[model samples]
Target: MSVTGLPSASGLPDLRQVTPVDEVGVNERVARFQTRSIKKESKIEALKMILSMIDLTTLEGQDTPGKVRQLCQKAIHLHDSMPGLPHVAAVCVYPTMVGVARKALGDCDINVASVATAFPSGMSSRKIKLEETRTAVAEGADEIDMVISRGAFLQGDYGFVFDEIAAVKEACGDAHLKVILETGELGTLDLVRRASVLAMHAGADFIKTSTGKIQPAATMPVTFVMLKAIKSFYFETGRMIGMKPAGGISGAKLAVHYLVMLRETLGNAWMTPEWFRFGASSLANDVLMQLQKQATGVYQSADYFSKD
Candidate 1:
């Protein structure tokens, strides 16, 4: 509500007034982004750019102190063999592991991003969610990725979802807040766009596509819908917002396609890591391989790239 695109009085945006998304048009436009041709040098540059914008994430229930530490290490020194490679933008982990990630990253420019608000499921009470976010921030997380209450949003309880996001944003304090919409569960592009509006109005610093738990996560159509909503909001209020397509983005070519979509939809301003990110766990390795191939003129085995 303190952000642009919402009424100053109540802080809750009316879902009824949201523009209806055209699923077909969205698909067509998404296809065009895929078709946009790039020269070899441009693609090499894009691969490096994608690497810099990666939020190297690990949210598995099996995540441990050691696993998070290894991931943190990877974030800092991706591939020493390749000269002048930029580190990843951030590392994402569960809230409990924020301290582990922070300590391992220790003074590195790479940010420590944590998933809070009961994460992948967002099924817990608001009290617990807010406390979890606060705990993550206190533990030195630079960014908090929170999930919206998908069950409530699916039940048409937009008020509950909106208020929950707003409260989580407040709990974040100085940390950036990324509101995950879990578009896979939203069931349609129209609803995805609506949720995008809700999250942005509720003060999300970034609107992520999914938590990477659900199947069909971060599909092109779903991301297109979310991008459209962001465009509409920016046009209406003249304020810039960030986007992160978190799940199922692993291949280098697909990542470049996403950059094309972001550039065409939100313009050059949103192209930076500050505004755009790929919330993927295995994506960094693939990007590194792509860069290696560009340098060596041969395909690479995954063994050369470090695993998350």
Candidate 2:
């Protein structure tokens, strides 16, 4: 069933043979996900689950050791006022801050994820990308979130993109590799689908939506297309890959809708943080507010939460 130009052996399916996305169908499907209703108790559980699936990220030019430590503390002690709260899945920071975050998290269950391979832009040489990945892993980063070269993929150099991801995966050693497609720059849903397939075939543990620096980051239609690609790839090759929709998702209801989409598309198997994640730092406060409102039947001020 491999498409002629897809080059599955080389870890890339021919783009011409890749299925063309039906934008209308995808949009219609995503619209339906927003309409599904969750019971009160179920919504409470969903909020907690969302909290645990967050990759609390701080990827900015002004990031410092102190800020990274504060972010780690927030991750470790999320709303200490609450009786019980699940720590986030990971703390995402730049490669230089990987050591800071790793030391700050100590032995907590939360993973330390570093964005390597010229993150956000993916404009550097492959050698530097691989070296950055290795350095992060050596610094105790449990996961590596590498951005794919959108320029290469956009120019139809699928092989280059595939090889780059494979190289990064190899450089990751034992650390999991999450490949960011930066769907915002991908331009079309069809291209997004192609990139998703290309990434998974190249040994990506997870296929991410964006780098959170793009305007149209992590839209439902884009995430939906990526999820479907993951499901299709899993059926083709018995391997389960994870999904992350970073940026632009900051509300509890919308986040819950994403969970609904994930459940319905990939089923309950991909429900955990290992298989899915939200790459938003501000999302945590919104979810916390929602949880408090649900518990006490009233919402709290956003000022109550720390904004690190």
Candidate 3:
């Protein structure tokens, strides 16, 4: 399919090949070594560390205006009320609701993220996709989460995928573009790696996995492949791209495992919110409970966790 009204074959790059990684040998070694000690942290300390990297974006389909506003308020409250209040990196919502989050967040320094480009499916016309991205950015979305056309990518139409991302990047202007590969549907480690490189070359600030709409989203094995791809891309272009594994990640322990993987695969530079993020809604409570457990030496019931 043609992306952004441009012919699929024109202004696109070949996607069958992989980038070389000979120069990153040293960085990879250092990352692997640093991550080796991930198992040493106590459960509570580990949870706190990972919770600090969360984005806490909400994207439920049943979200109403009232609920969206409530989520925004809760996010703001968390930013203020929580002790030592490590604010979530962003508050993600639908494109139409960007204004709600923007109005509620108001100079809070938290990014307002929106999912566009036929999100969750990516099966729309390129014109609509571009307009969607442009509209989201115009609506004050600081970060744009877009899904790749799996049909086109799997059909050997890598060029189509690449141009789509590039066109969306152009629409984003100053907004950060996060390209979601929908790794569950991509179905192979090699495709994940190729898609990662394609997104980076097309100007993606981050390469994400899943729309949180698919089953088996964000597995560690797939994440491992994508992290390696990020490492390889950095070696080639010297541009550090972010990684986000969304969907079904609901507990502090799982988040820490992802953090450990990131620390091991990309080193300390990748540990911060700029380089890594977990897209989750229920994860915060689990992390909080773990934190409470650490403080009191007893596990807290689910009731003790905040429902916001």
Candidate 4:
């Protein structure tokens, strides 16, 4: 109920006081971000930063140990010819594949992230969601990507949604939790802003945009609204929060625009992979291709990069 959108004494944000989003203002700001130009040197550096911030994901029904290991290898040795390219932020997979990815990543700094809580749908019971989270963390998952129950949230059961996130965060123990808002299904920018505030107040280390499973995923305007929400939350609580915009962001140019938006909105403190990430499946390869172009002055064939 505080003016800054911080949690009330009862530990839940007052949804009534959550700021309403300005869609027109957000759209105009996003358009300006796209128009800002970066010099070639800055562009190359931005590409490298993008590569490091990506969470190379493979959340598929057909995911197998072999396939997961191959993806891990790609994460470790992303374009060996480049020599100094940084590995991705993490490898995201189903909870069953978390151990496989962990063992494959070896001692490298790359994290093993698992999508739990009946991922993509989030239609299971709270007990099941908590147990799944514990299992993934026990199996060596460093990060847990949990989807919020949009149906409950949309039905005005904000307290239920808040409690679920807090319970899941406790189950995660040492693992960081990334709460996916799935903005596409939320229906409006105001709801997206409200959900972002709720997630952060309920113990989410990061507030994510989508599951990469639906249309209108991770649009510039949606991300802009979330970033602004994060700014307000930090001003109130003096605690930093991370942001991740998943799905539909494949090209290096669009990714750069996002970075520009982040820097301009949140300043330099949040410019690292630890504070921001991209939950993507193919974004790594596209960034590699772009980096290669920057290095060689000509685009390399898409086949040059692995599609794992």
Candidate number that wins on TM-score, 1 or 2: 2
| Deviation (Å) of 40 in candidate 2 | 1.0
Per-candidate TM-score against the hidden true structure = 0.96, 0.97, 0.87, 0.97
lDDT scores in order: 0.88, 0.93, 0.79, 0.92
Residue-by-residue lDDT tens digits, candidate 3, 198-249: 8888899998999988987987777777889889878977989999998888
- 1-308 per-residue lDDT for model 1 (tens digits): 13433344656787778988877888888889999987698998899899999999998889989999999889998998999898899999998999999999989799999999988899898899999999999999999999998888887777778888888988999999999999888898878988999899889999999989998799888887888888898998787789999889999999999998888888898889999999998888998988898999999999767787
| Clash counts for the predictions, in order | 0, 4, 0, 0
148, model 2: CA deviation in Å?
0.7
Candidate 1 clashing pairs, residues 3+ apart or interchain: none
Q: Candidate 2 residues 1-308, lDDT tens each?
A: 22335566665766687788999999999999999998699999999999999999999999999999999999998898987889899999999999999989998789999999998899999999999999999999999999999998887777888889999999999999999999999999999999999899899999999999998999999999999999999999999999999999999899999999999999999999999999998999999999999989987899887774
Model 2 lDDT, residue 70, Cα: 97
Instruction: Write the number of the candidate with greater TM-score, choosing between 2 and 3.
Output: 2
**Candidate 1 local Cα displacement, residue 265, angstroms:** 0.9
Scored against the true structure, residue 93 in model 3 reaches a CA lDDT of: 92
Worst 10 residues of 1 by lDDT: 1-10
